[model samples]
Target chain A: MNQEQFEIYRHLAGRLIDGQLSPGSHIESEQELARKFSTTRMNAYRAIKQLERRGIVSRSKRAGTRVSAPVNPNLLRQLKCEMTRRICVIHSRNSYEYLHWTGEFRRTLQQALAAEDFTLEDVHLDDVRDRAELKEKLLRLTETGIAAFILSVRGEEDEFLIENSDLFFQYHNKIFVYQSGAMSWMHWPFHTVTVNIFGEGSLAAKYLMEKGIRKIAYCRREISSKNYLDFNRERLLGVEFTMRRLSDGRNKPEEWVGLEQIYRNCMENGSGCGLIVSTDELAARIIDYFAERGAKRPPEMISFDNNSEYDSYRLTTIAPPHVEMAQTLGRLIFDNIDIDSECGFVSYIKIDSKLIINHQE
Target chain B: MNQEQFEIYRHLAGRLIDGQLSPGSHIESEQELARKFSTTRMNAYRAIKQLERRGIVSRSKRAGTRVSAPVNPNLLRQLKCEMTRRICVIHSRNSYEYLHWTGEFRRTLQQALAAEDFTLEDVHLDDVRDRAELKEKLLRLTETGIAAFILSVRGEEDEFLIENSDLFFQYHNKIFVYQSGAMSWMHWPFHTVTVNIFGEGSLAAKYLMEKGIRKIAYCRREISSKNYLDFNRERLLGVEFTMRRLSDGRNKPEEWVGLEQIYRNCMENGSGCGLIVSTDELAARIIDYFAERGAKRPPEMISFDNNSEYDSYRLTTIAPPHVEMAQTLGRLIFDNIDIDSECGFVSYIKIDSKLIINHQE
Candidate 1:
């Protein structure tokens, strides 16, 4: 396989693999091939002879060169099979609505996919409002001749999936949904992955409890945005459940408080008041609030999403496995693409979150 | 190597591999070894001498054969490393409290783990109720010297985790949790997996909307058992979100009506009203009620967790990917066990459910 032969072989293989040069396609004469590659006619003949020897094609001076046709239908399908290496990623409005983390998530995922030789076919659905429009957008995106997708959706858009149910399932083998709100609409199984936000909450409760902090004040945004209602609600439920388990007739905090109230109340009431804030920024601010008023944080404190910028702050927080998640997502989508297995089980992948401790600020 | 020499060599290799014959241990004399495996004294001598040639052991007339001290710490550690293939599995009281799906989930998961050569060490927590007792149970389970776990929790028992948080994190690398109630506890990072019920709800709402049912009544138990409260709540929220998205100037039913009311109200109201029941059984019953009343079920209907037994009923139900969930659980636990990278990402796997439409009664 010399350089010219290798080049010619690769080009032919690509065409054959992509079905452009399907099982029965004919190859050009040696003279015509020589003109195409600007190579000698003898060299073109050698390339055709090589293809003939491999049984990829039948060649003769009288009959010309024709790709070998399969006798069996299954064999022909196998020979004509083309793999989809290009991936189109569509993030949910929720990912966009909360720009701080999800925005970075989208970028990191794109980079990771690119590194894996999966070219990105970006589908912008950041403005897909209401169920009908989301359906239209998703259906339109699927129609763009893209065979693979990584679609993220808030639960609200799932109704659109119900509208395009069969179409989605037909391609479910090639579809991956991340951080989806469509769990209920799972009439069809496919690969779905999300960071376990609810899990993050339970972890926080247990951590504060481990520090032997009794009556831990559960903290979060006094009023979170609507898109994150489910996120905030589920996490709070986890903390409350743990708080109940630990209460044990102990004078635990009576209510879930906001940052200002929790900080003020806990600082004023006592030091045994432990805390679990939903975000690291909120956690750091609570710490700062105490410091500004010439007080130290309660004995126990933990936050969510360990913001690396707050390394000096040294607060314990749950770290989302963003990099590993992107890697795993890429692996699952490519590794599990069996177009005919649409009725098979849907994999719900949950990437582990880390609890980072020890900070100065 | 002769037959006798090969036999002698194999026996010593087995002992060395098993760490039964560690460094500084002296091998018996050739005469003494001749008694074992019925090998000749010469063959035994040859085996020890061969070991000496390979620097695996030292030989001296007085000392007999002594295993050599490892020169490299890494190599020593590699040689000393033992595999942990068994996992301790604990199911929440909630999974048990209900005798239907969750029990099946527990059994299927156990079987799946066994098929993968991973045995489950069932940590009996059926009697555990109080936080202290749950803590005691967890502490006792960990003490069994089993490094790996697959703990399932209802958010209720998360306090016990807080009790043993430190001990849990120390062995966090080997821990896996399924059906976890402790997602809120993200105190330690390890593998955690659970089914996403919220996704199920969104799927239901989408399905109903796709049927063009405007007044979709959300139906569920007026007051479910404490264990399934979060389960029902999250799903209903998914439906409500979709309902809100679908609701325009059209007159919609009041939020979250009871089962009896939904069946009665929707059946009387004719074709415009649809229903998204919380379960297939509930949906089937609702349909039956309409049938019994000599009325046709509304144009649109969707349910959760399709009971395959009701094949004749032909209900569209979201079937939980239990088998696939269990299999994925087993694969993720074993596949992601990077013995070297201990304090790393532990994936929280969420298996996707299937929505079966036109499923026979």
Candidate 2:
């Protein structure tokens, strides 16, 4: 194509690809375009002919030139290469306000993507009332030129995705499942990022013992009846395994009923009691309970979910590394954006939770 | 000003207002301006003369027409009015990584502002090595035409801000302090928005009781030695006051040692026992401990901070209205953007924590 023809073709195609010129929209006539661009009618004719040949537009005597209703796949792919900067995050609705760390996860992810001139759009998958609604939503969303889709998979949501597995499997390379631990039951191949719950437990136990906790209690939360994915069991194994190994099979950390019982036992026994709570929320409760009563902080303690809320707390916590998680998702999406699923193997990224110590004594 | 002159003037002022033309930078000469805007040199000269009289630019044979060195007060005010769309958030460095909810707050604020085309720039005020350094950094930042400032105050950071009260007091209308509760010691006449920690406590207790909790336990964490500003007391008072009122002075919730003890006690008591944990973190622990043991979730329970991390937990939680808080701050900043400090009075906005019930029966 000559310079003028190339210019006109690029302008029209760009707008059509962006949906600014929808299907069936009439393109400017050759004479009209020739006047607009200050070019010869022949040049305008050549540009329209080029577009028509590519199947991006159709030329007819009565219709003149109209954008192809279905759009050309090759042209759409080119548009995706240049304009696909949106990442879709799937989670339950209103999780940002209720679910802990989700808001942080989203913020970190958004900030990371924004730096690369990409955007994060949240899709509350749980809000879809039924399987059919979810399927329709996913179909429409996937059809749009989203660079990537991040599914913060939970129980019901996981089931929903699996039900629509065929659609997801087709675009596996473009999908990522951010989970707490690998689900052994469900097996659909996609890029999976898991925070090592077991490692967090092990790390917490080790950190507490190193702080001279003679009697370490792994005070896990009572399991919810609705908990199909119980990470506490995995965490408990890590804590128990680590304690046995560190103590040479002598000192096993006891599973306590609740923080209050542990605190009472520690007070009665008179010090050197360390705690490895299940989550930072639990650890914070322990801290607040002691503080309200004017009691000193325990000799040592650690908890998981190094949630950003407890940054001021003087307690060691196991953080899931939200920033790293977000970055990993961002990196995976970027690397696999153009990759074919056939060549892409299912990648399981397991990141160990870090022990953040804000405790001075 | 004629149409040509106005066009040239608007173009130049917009650039200067946007900080594209920094103070002391030489602006386009009259001849250059005439050629660029395709206007008569006399019209360009008249525009330059208007800018000079407005104190936006100065003319000298050696310097040519240059932006004013000190930048005229009125011109700077106009720049602020037209271009100050960037909000400054002061927080500890690396907070986005470690601190809980701080990242969420920042993200929420950024999203809220971005809708209005405003950008949020974070200032790691705690990263400043010394008080002098902090003062210098703040002086420079405050000098820039920032729309408004939001200070997420903490201990040492709060002290630093207090020490620089004189500077903050001057820009009181344009400054907002987002705090957990009011600090009685530091009396700065700035627009203050505080999350009602006391109300959260009261709400939690009331909700737990309403859930048919007979034997109630108010679990608070042990206070850290570094916890100079203890909010547990405020929360405890709220809980105690509400409990006394609700029970008609017949029953009072006992402050427990930790969640384990509460769990053990509740199990022993055999149902209808309720727990009011200080934070959502603590409440999550109770749920986890119960879940770990395969026990039913305590008959009734409530916690505070409604931190987004524990959204999946079924327990009702008292959540600091972060969205409301951010919106309030944004609204205050926008409404008062052009108002003089003399005409604006200090605003104390207290938002009650919402009771987010994810628990069923």
Candidate 3:
């Protein structure tokens, strides 16, 4: 798409030739690489997606992007099998407990690797932020013969790294990201763990309607995320669809309550309200708030699970199949499917949530 | 006391002097080492306990054994500081998510640590049967320059480790374990986050008595834990104390109800009953089980909290302070206290629990 992206592709291809980037290894996210090269997320995504299309990597929603397995003999035949390939795992400090599932996953991975006589060196970096620090760490990994990396990047900071995919490629390292949607602006070869946000939203709406709730409110945080916005639009559409089915040409409702406006409305009204909370934790908090303030509870409140260990509110929620998702991702990484090929690839995987009704609200 | 213990102490002292052992690192449990070394739990406990008495290590209920912080050569040259240099953290992971306010305490610990520039590394080994894998991982950490470890050991496994502390110490590690009265027989400490079972049980009993429930059934899981047994015994004592104060030395109740048996008895007799379930999960399960089976609901039921995330049951529960505990433990670790000293040590820290009354009990 651009000179920088082309350069990145060249460098990445060179690494594949030199065996520096091996099969079944995970690369850094587009955001991480963009930051490293001081560029845009668009460019970075372009470079990576191109590589992916070339069968260099495989991507999924929960597993992020990873190097395809089945070694390309022309690329790695010269390297020793026991060189102790180093891999870096970067995660936010606050997410330590939530990510503990990784520990168990890692153990299982290690055992699997050991069975095949492959040695792995893992380096865990916690509370990582700042582009310079990230670059320094990546450089260190390279200096120490690190073959690949796994990162969970957060926020808008990813944009910078996406633009610099060419620079990353020049260094003979592959980069991958864990995103849930198509980056229409970028044509680079990269992999991602994409979720069916639209479908999930529709399901939420349908579930609420089934409970005999006509007046509904949707609550979400103020943060801007493409995934969140996509889900919101889809959920609204689903609600409208259900409403239209029931109304028989009746007039549409005039007001839609936002999260900030929920408390006032809840306090003012006694009943006949249904709420679809964006996340379970938030729903719990809202329930607790209402309880403390002596407000009448809603007839039905639905929430989405985000792998939290504690729920602040006693409510009915839809839980994601986290374990199943984790396992599927693990299998994909272990298998190392070709990114370019559509044959035998799982294009989409959607999980359903169950209704767990509690007594509190 | 025994040959194995004598050797363990000898090895422990060597590790301390060599700087291979660090302050606040957890050692193997008495039962664990004993099994590994083909010795008895008492032998292992005696050795570690002897070291503890000599100011070489520090031990507590669930916290496991740990090497006291060594005096900094620089500090030693200046002036003597009387501070206890050991750090201890006691944690409990039980399915009883509704019990004892454990989760709340953990959060408090996290907040406290956040105020400082330190982070906690948690490795949750859900079951003790994975000890060999745990040991391997621990050894790998040591190789990767991790100086201390915290863990929770369970069952007869405590004796094996304590008896074989010599081998463990030689590997350059320390441990702390929680202990409470005669129940030391259940000492299976790797490194634990302990709870005040006796105190909490007594409080629960007192609260129920105040609510006018004289014939209360203690509903517990089929496979009980040491904490459960301890809490039940203490609660019984408290209930007895309260009854003594209220009665004129005439009425004495002999029958107590276990969870399963209570259901059968109630069904056969059509009697109204009040219940105190061991943990929240169990309580929720009991409710679900009855509702599904078309059994009449109990009049009143109370349960303990381990701060579980599932709120599907929403029964009345005693909420633990897990957040606080996690925060506290994080701070203690960051402070870098010396475990070898007895002076200036806080013997025990207990947080109060609150009752959250919900319907559908």
Model 1 C-alpha lDDT per residue in residues B290-328, reported as the tens digit of each score: 788787765677777667666667887787766766766
lDDT (0-100) at residue B295 of candidate 3? 85
Question: Could you arrange the candidates by DockQ from highest to lowest?
Answer: 1, 2, 3
lDDT of 3 at B66: 84
> Lowest-scoring 10 consecutive residues by lDDT in candidate 2 chain B?
B92-101
DockQ of each: 0.11, 0.01, 0.01
**Candidate 3 C-alpha lDDT tens digits along A291-323:** 787765566777765434445456667654444
For residues A1-361, write the lDDT of model 1, one tens digit per residue.
4456545655665576567776677878888888899998887777776667546799766777888853333222222222344566665444322422365666777776676455776666557666567656654554344547666555533344344443443322366776523133332344666665556666777687776766666677676544445566656655655555444324333445576787668857687677777677787787788888888766577887667666677887787776766767776765565332333334555555778877554
Q: How would the candidate models be sorted by TM-score, starting from the highest?
A: 1, 2, 3
Off by over 4 Å in 3: A1-87, A92-129, A153-176, A179-188, A224-260, A267-270, A306-309, A337-355, A359-361, B1-361
- TM-scores for all candidates? 0.49, 0.38, 0.34
Provide the overall lDDT of each model, using Cα atoms, as 2-decimal numbers. Answer: 0.60, 0.64, 0.48
Please, what are the lDDT tens digits per residue for candidate 2 over residues B234-270?
Answer: 5665676567655644567777767677777887878
- Residue-wise C-alpha lDDT for candidate 3, range B1-361, written one tens digit per residue: 3346655655655555457777887777888878877888887887787667655578888787887757344222111211112222312343222233334544565466556432445554354344465456444444433323333333112333333332232233234333221123221212233444433444555566666766666666655555445445654543443344333223222334555675775576454456767667677677767777788666677777633554766677776545544544454454333333222111122334456777663
Which scores greater on lDDT, model 2 or model 3?
A: 2
lDDT of 3: 0.48
Q: Taking the tens digit of each residue's C-alpha lDDT, what string does model 2 give over A60-82?
A: 88778888766654356544433
